[model samples]
Target chain A: MPKHILRLIILFVIVIGLFLVARQFLIPESFGEYGHYRANSIEENANHDIKYVDRAECAECHDDIAALKQGGPHKNINCQTCHGPGNLHIEDPTPENIVKETEREFCGRCHNKNAARAKLIKQIDINEHNIESKCIECHNPHEPWN
Target chain B: MELNKKNKKTRRDFLKLSSAIAGSVAFYSMFKPIESVANRKTDVTEREHWYGFGFDIEKCIGCGLCAKACKIENDVPREPFFFRTWVEQYTIKNGHIIKDENVIVESPNGGIDGFTQSVPDKEIFKSFFVPKTCNHCYKAPCVQVCPVGATFETPDGVVLVDDSYCVGCGYCIQACPYGARYLHPEKKTADKCTFCYHRLKKGLAPACVDVCPTGARMYGDLDDKEGPLVQFIKNHTCRVLKPHLNTKPKLFYNALNEEVR
Candidate 1:
């Protein structure tokens, strides 16, 4: 064969070989192992400390509150909605860590008057709907009507 | 005579060498697409569940409970601008008198706080809240545009970001028509709703669905013919956002108004 053609063949082989070698190193160790993404990503995402303990977790200890909340308007609301995430409180069992938001403004988040809201759903103007007292004073958070 | 024979031999050898090179290049080119096909055919027997989501506009009360739950559940940034899921309030007041007049759509702070009315009650004819989230498109432009394959869809139809591999080019964010993605200022990677993948893996509902006061949102296996989601789709008139784009979004909206765009 011609010397130039032989040399060109040698160069092509070397370049392609380098690309194959680089691909081995460049690609992630777990790439395309599970799905289109790296397999480790599933584990990485799972590793995040779960902050919101579902209502069942709260029911384990606070069954009285759970019973009260059942079938009520706020039954759908998770326990952590008013009280903060219960993970720390569940782990430590401390009053300070688990919040008790009895403030009127806290209740006003959903209850406050908004013209955009549906007429059928209950809402209130905090100023008119008992401005002098906290929401808990008139209504129990667990079973508000009672 | 020997010199002539030598010249012919060399010419024949050169032809063989050139043909060999062309054959090798052609073989390599042929395998390129096949390799991608092999990548796509990775084992998917483990993920039996295929998820799809639905929203009932009639049920949503613009309370923003879902948005708040998502932020806390996903550890999204506390900034008002960031949201994995949000609610948009569409108010059409005196809509009959005027064309698209007194129509207001707003999601202040991603509706983290419940929406307040901008137009007066007297002028308003009708209003409804439309919750928005990542559609998890089957032909997701975000996944297609990712330079590093950082954004990808799982076997079970969830679009997720491999944060470890992401180069944060912001291409995926721009590719999304529904504006579902945003760059996390702290993580420096594109962030959006995973449909709460972590929670789903743990056999829990997405945070938004978990805290929905009115059962306005539903998530379930689309493959399950008997599932409530499929039944709901069959019974109710549903539409996806921006069907004209042909993204094949999985988020189905019931009672979606034309003005929602």
Candidate 2:
């Protein structure tokens, strides 16, 4: 072979070698193990701390309130939906940690009259629906219809 | 010169023979039946689990508890614009479902604050609330458009984003037809629902489904033939969002209004 051809072959090999070495460093170890993404990411995405506890967890301790809620219109509603996340309260069992929303505005979030709301949901004009007293005073949140 | 000519002819003949063999091999392989990516079976363990989601529009009361639960569960931004899930109220006037002007859609605070009537009762021909989230499509456009391989579909049929790998390109955000993806303001990476993958792994339902007071939402493994999700799909005439796009979305809706897009 000519000297120039030998030099070109050496240069080509060096370029290919550099690319192979670079790929080892640049590409992630787990890439293409499952698909195109990093395999470890699946575990990472699945490892977040569960902020919302199941209703069964609340029922474990508050069986009385759970029993009251069971027969109500809001039977299907999770306790944490209104009280906020109960994970912290589950650990401490403190009344201060869990919210006790009694304000009309809090009730108005769902109960206030809205045309977009489904006809099945009980809605009322917050202004005219017994304005003087809180919702819990007249309508028991546990069994509102009763 | 005689020897040189013979050597050249032999080399040319070898090249031709090798080329013919290569061509024949390529031609044979082309005709051979190969399993497509869609039909390819995953591992037995992975095949045993395939998640699906559905909701009943008739049952949804626009309570917004699902929206609130998702935000708190995922630690999504509190701003009205940012949402992993949201509820949209569609109001149609004069029963003109086809006309764009006849329909009015609103989702104030992503319907975390309960919806109020916008269209008058007299003009309103029909109206309903639609809770929207990532569909986790089988052929997801977001996964296809991601400049980096940060977004991918798992073997068990859940689409997920690798936060650490994302380059914050926003390509996937724009590509998603359902408007499910959003750029995380703090992380600068594209973020969306994971179908609550963490909770699902722990055998818990997605946060939105967990908080649905009216039992509007349903979720279960499709691999379980007796699962509620599969049963719901079997019993109800379910429809997906933008079926023409061919995303093959896993999210199904029953009693979905034709006006809803």
Candidate 3:
């Protein structure tokens, strides 16, 4: 109701707006690039949890898996998808192992969906695209992406 | 100007001084010509050296192994953009040079795979595997047209991008007629076949050459006369990927019958 109070409220709003606007400019681009932004991610319990692992570390003892990677469509797929958590595997190197799937169907967690572009991998095809068999039917999981 | 008689030195003395200066200069230069050292080993000879690739068109099956192997080796960026290498399976089917594009494939379905084709033994097709790689042209248009000097030809003749230098102008993208280059999204650089220089330097074969069930994709030093490529050149007549671009593509396709062009 008073002009002085109205001016003070407008100034408060501007300060809040500036803080929000400058958030991106202050934050590093790579800050959130790697992880799942959703609230349900595995690491959400921690105050600061950013988890990721490049594939080479997985190939260490999983030479069979690595060799299989050489033979599969998932050769290019980042191993973290089906391998579950990676930082723990890197630290322990033994207990958190790859939960191998029955067939090539295991490779489809991220690949199963159509992406931003028209689907490069129609992994959903066995059910949706009308392909006769699962992924391995025409593919060799150890040597797939070409 | 005032004329000088006694103030000037004798012409004979000046000639003697000039001759002595000229003789010393000649003697000093004769002993050292540019101070060249023993020939240094080139980066091309090092692990980064570029090896030229050529193909035998007659033997190509259109199996798409070259395209596929590149995707595996590089983890090619996906979709609406077929990458790296693709097979142009040419055939005289239905009385036409039926060109089939067996490009890079991501396989939930195994649609298209590589630059070399791997037709099954039981199947019937008038096709062969013609493996393709970056042509590594001497005067690569991709290199010359880059607005940011991102794409550059190496001393070894392989045209490469200094991804750091790339501004994502996409000029090199348009300049390439062969469709050899693409804009890498994460890095925002122009990416293309490096001819697997990293492996070649280790004395290992390119991934496609390694995976080819048939020994279709081969790499060797084109400059070396004793190299397998020169030996093959001497033994058989082959064709370069595109002669008209005048890029002088090192990749050669062999065994192309006149019928399949």
Task: Write candidate 1's Cα lDDT for B1-261 as tens digits.
Answer: 987775665777889999999999999999999887776653446558879999988888787878988898898998987889999988887757357666778889988877667777788777788999999998999999998889888878888888989988999999999999999999899999998888887877887887776788999998888999998888899999999999999999999988888
Over the stretch B205-233, how does candidate 3's per-residue lDDT look in tens digits?
A: 55555544334566777777788877776
Give per-residue CA lDDT, model 2, range B1-261, as digits (tens): 986775565777889999999999998787664633444447656576888889899887787889998999999999978899999988888765677999899899999987778777899888888999999999999999987799999988899999989999999989999999999999999999999999998888888998887889989887787889889989999999999999999999999887788
Worst 10 residues of 1 chain B by lDDT: B38-47
Residue B80 alpha-carbon offset, candidate 2, angstroms: 2.2
List, in order, the clash count of every candidate structure: 0, 0, 37
DockQ of each: 0.50, 0.67, 0.02
Best-to-worst lDDT order: 2, 1, 3
CA lDDT for candidate 2: 0.87
Cα RMSD for predicted model 2 = 2.9
What residue runs in model 3 are displaced by over 4 Å at the alpha carbon?
A1-146, B1-50, B96-111, B114-129, B257-261
Q: TM-scores of the first chain across all predictions?
A: 0.84, 0.92, 0.40
Q: Candidate 2: lDDT of B51?
A: 83
| Candidate 2 DockQ, CA atoms | 0.67
Give the top-scoring candidate (lDDT): 2
Task: Give the clashing residue pairs of candidate 2, or none.
Answer: none
Best by TM-score: 2
lDDT of 3 by residue, A1-146 (tens): 57999999999999999999898686434322222111121121112222334446678877887887776554654454334435566777775353444453343432433221113334352245444566756656567554
Choose 1 or 2, whichever is better by DockQ. 2
